[model samples]
Target: MKVCFVGSSGGHLMHLYMLKRFWADKERFWVTFDKEDARSLLGEEKMYSCYFPSNRNIKNLIKNTFVAAKVLKNEKPDVIISSGAAVAVPFFYIGKLLGAKLIYIEVFDRIDKSTLTGKLVYPITDKFIVQWEEQKTVYPKAINLGSIF
Candidate 1:
């Protein structure tokens, strides 16, 4: 199955990268920022660079949404998975609309409360996973799959 992995840079991307073994054997591509870490880690991988200043940036959000639409249209992945910050928001929404299964993993941080991306994508995601049991209280429908780290 074709998979589209979407996440922001830093910890969000790290969390997703931890699952390399899971997607290693699958046909996959990535949606992330064009940052140093992303470039270094995903050097040989297929990727689509998302816009920066994504969170709360209405302009970039709209721009990235359009870009995400094109990526989704071209990739046509069966599953779209993310450990988010902001970039995943547009991708998840557009992927769902395009009939792709959405899987969202709440980041390893934020044990106290749900993140904005988590709250927004919860209703639409086909599978919602949380690292902490406390997060399950915030996302009752989410499965506690332990830490991705």
Candidate 2:
């Protein structure tokens, strides 16, 4: 299956990368910041640079929505997965419209509180995985898969 891994750089990107066991055998591409860490980590991989400084930035959010529409439409992945810091929003929303299954893994650091990105995508995600059981209280339908670390 074709997979789209989307997230911001650093920890969010690392979280998705940790799932190599799942995406390793699948045809995959990435959507993330053009930062040094992401550039080094994803070198030689098919990747699309996304708008960044994405935290509560309405401008980049709108820009990324357009980016999401174009990239997701052309790549057309069967599934889109993320452990997010904000960049996942546009991709998940647009991917859902394009009939891709959406998966969101709540970040491992937030145990009791739900992330803004997790809350926003939960209603639409096909699979919502939590790294902590306490997170399930915040995301009642989320499956506690323990930490991805």
Candidate 3:
């Protein structure tokens, strides 16, 4: 299956990277920030950069929505996954419309509450995962996958 892994530059990106076992053998690419760390870690991977400072940033959100349309159209990944900040919103929405399965892994840290991105995408996500069992209270339908670390 083809996968599109999308997230922000730091821990969110790291969370997705931890799924290498699942993605390594698949046809996959990434959508993340074009920061130094992402550049270094995904040096040899197919990647697309997205607009950042995405939290509450209308302009970047609009820009990333366009980026999402273009990339998801081009890649046509069968699945899209993220442990996100805010960047994943646009991609998940468009990917769902494009008939790609969406998986949103709630960050390992947020134990009982939801992140903004998680809350925004939960209704549309095909699989919503949480690292802590306690988080199930907030995302009742979420599967408890434990830490991807």
Q: Candidate 2 — which pairs collide?
A: none
State residue 129's C-alpha deviation in candidate 2, in Å: 0.3
Greater TM-score among 1 and 2 belongs to 2
lDDT per residue, candidate 2, 1-149, as tens digits? Answer: 99999999999999988888988888999999999999999888899999989989999999999999999989999999999978899999999999999999999888888889998999999999998888889999999888888
lDDT of each: 0.92, 0.93, 0.94
Q: Which one wins on lDDT?
A: 3
Instruction: Report clash pairs, candidate 3.
Output: none
Stretches off by above 4 angstroms in model 1 are: none
Candidate 2 global CA lDDT score? 0.93
lDDT of 1 by residue, 22-101 (tens): 99999999999999999998989999999987888999999999999999999999999998988999999999899999
Q: Write the per-residue lDDT of candidate 3 for residues 1-149, one digit (tens) a residue.
A: 99999999989999899888888899999999999999999989999999989998999999999999999999999999999989999999999999999999999889978899999999999999999999999999999978787
Which ranges of candidate 3 are over 4 A from the true structure? none
In angstroms, the error of model 2 at 26 is 0.7
| Number of the candidate with higher lDDT, 1 or 2 | 2
For candidate 1, what's the RMSD? 0.7
